[model samples]
Target chain A: MRRSALVVDDSRVVRKAARRMLEGFGFSVREAEDGEQALIACRAEALPNVVLLDWNMPVMDGITFLRAARAEFGADRPPIVLCTTESEFSRIVEALQAGAQEYIMKPFDATILGGKLAQIGLLDAAEVPA
Target chain B: MSGSSPDTFAAIAGLVKARAGIVLTPDKGYMLDTRLAAILRRGNFASLAALAQALRDPRGEPLVRDVVEALTTNESSFFRDGKPFEHVKRILPALHAARPAGARLRIWSAACSTGQEAYSLALLLADQLPALAGRQVDILGTDLSREVVERAREGVFSQFEVQRGLPVQMLVKHFIQEGGKWRIKPALRAMCRFEERNLLGEHRGLGGFDLIFCRNVLIYFDTPTKAKVLAALAAQLAPDGALYLGGAETVLGLTDRLVPLPGERGVYGPAPALARSA
Candidate 1:
């Protein structure tokens, strides 16, 4: 099945690039500029299968959004993949504990991203890793 | 309750029920106080009475709507439960078999908060219905709130949104990492549309749907409103079509036009009478 994803970040360039990459892999993409916008967008559409979220943003940050969304969406919440530059093991554990399903560091290779996507089950095995 | 009078409580309760269809009891005064206290503070009112006075003013109609909207929770997620999609899997094959060649297959998600439920359905169809891959399949989602509808159209979600109920495999297949968020690809999104629609109002323009999912929304309505919404849904459903409600909801006592589909507990089929009538 073709999967749909919601990419939340503050940077337009990042949103565009990610959109391109996902589309290249045959997945559909949606964008949000910040956490509040992302929360509103998430509520506005049919829920995407996965969410690519940034840690920091204006208005509402990633962690706060995660807590609220987890409480609101309950067991049906999407599998969250944290896309951030924070690589410290403590930070990763904090994110995982805060409800992130997976973590992808910044400046990641497209192939590595694809591998991570595949590892998470958003892509099929035959598809080349990002 | 300190300075609040019973008369003020009655008036506020009446307004809530009339405007938002929320049936508040006298015992819920504390809830009323808590929910509206912020409004009072924002308006610079000293007490709930002052807030109620403003609410009763014709000028405060918008404020009333805002209050109700604020109080009405918009809690939702994508792929809420795993089983509904499983049922969708079974129904798709049957729907394809029942449909004529090249005919469009349509699904409407009423009260599609954000777009999770609708997209979840789209993913299921795309994955399971290969014959339908290139066919004309319209997955339309509608909600009463304009803000929610606008967000649904944008289709952006956070890490938390992605983690709710989605499987990791679906995530990898469907999403791309951008910054710290994941955005749905356009192709998957292309199959669906979102609109602002109030189920209690007229649905003349929305064409007949092969499957209508009004999950988890009816619990907010009173029995009469539920009956009205169900009747409207029955009118929009095609013969042999199905309806899915929240696990806690049922049409058994509320309406005769929807009979529980065998083997699927929450799934209901249109009553024979409605089928023949339609």
Candidate 2:
């Protein structure tokens, strides 16, 4: 089965870029413009195995969504990767502490993104195309 | 604010730094209050001052340890950043080529919380290094917390745990869906081992490693502790091996035993001293 991912960001370009990147890596991608929409989508459908969350979204920020998701799903929540431009080390630490499984700084290459997914055991070697 | 005293806070801070090499800031007073409130209430202490007195007593040894554990952050997950594993994959063939016949290749995931980091490496090795399928490859994961180690050994994860950094097909292939949780497949689980070992304590008999990922764990240590741990890690590194630290961490001024390898960001090579000696 093709793995599914929910790409949540405020920017259309980022969402489109991430969707393309995830699809190229064999993921069936879903898009949300903001954290509020992402949360609604999560509760409305079968949750995606992973969520690529953006930190600075309007209406609901990544941190608020993270807390809410943890509350809703408890320990069963999907893995959330915070996709942000925040380069401060303290903020990265804060995100990890707040239950983000991983943090990927913005402007990431697709190959690097695949490797991150693979490192977390999300991408099996057999699954990747030759 | 009942019973809070500067002396008590100072003593606790000193002990924590001495034991774990963490620097406790004044701002952490809130953290102390929040974490230690339960213990204070249980002991019938009305103030931090009373709790401090108890901590000074001979019977407070275990309490101190608990306080340290409570304050010490152990946040982590498998395959923390994506690029490092990409680097691992790119370098694996060369690493395999350099190995001597019959020599076992080992990898260590220091501060491996809940086993994700170590298991991630094992899965990657199993998938990419075909020659290692039946070979003796040791993947060891160690953490300072017994609680986290126990969780890692179980090889069970909540949907959330498996979701983070995990892809769908791999989830289906490498993990078994059991109720609301996911369990790692036996074949993948068998490739890795987990233990509880303090980075500051005596070195466990972990044999030499081809790659050592001592990532975010080192950021907590002060300079002296970081230097000591780096030296110890270097001692267990193969001459041509690599070490991966957190993105924010570097060995530049800490030790000359680890020289940065070009084209590999956040990775350091064994110092020339060890390379020449080997």
Clashing pairs counted in every model: 61, 6
Off by over 4 Å in 1: A1-130, B1-5, B27-46, B274-278
Least lDDT summed over 10 consecutive residues: which range in candidate 2 chain B? Answer: B160-169
| Residue A45 miss distance in model 1 (angstroms) | 46
CA-lDDT, candidates in order = 0.76, 0.78
Candidate 2 i-RMS (Å)? 11.4
Please report how far candidate 2 places residue A72 from its true position, in Å.
Answer: 35
Candidate with top DockQ is: 2
- DockQ of all models, two decimals each: 0.03, 0.06
Q: Write the per-residue lDDT of candidate 1 for residues B1-278, one digit (tens) a residue.
A: 43568988878777766765656667767876677777777779888788778888888877787666555557776666556767888788788888898898899999898888888887777687666555678999998767788877887777656655555446666766565566777877888899987777888688799999998878877899888888889889887788989878888678777888988968888889855467
B1-278 per-residue lDDT for model 2 (tens digits): 42346787787777777766777777677767887888777778887777767777887888777767766777665556667888888877777778777777788988888888888887787677675545667788888777788888999987556655664446655877676577899988888899988888766477688899988877878888898888888888888888999878999788878888898778988889765366
Question: Interface RMSD for each candidate model?
Answer: 10.9, 11.4
Q: Provide the lDDT at A36 for model 1.
A: 84
Cα lDDT over the full model 2: 0.78
Question: Deviation in angstroms for B156 in model 2?
Answer: 1.5
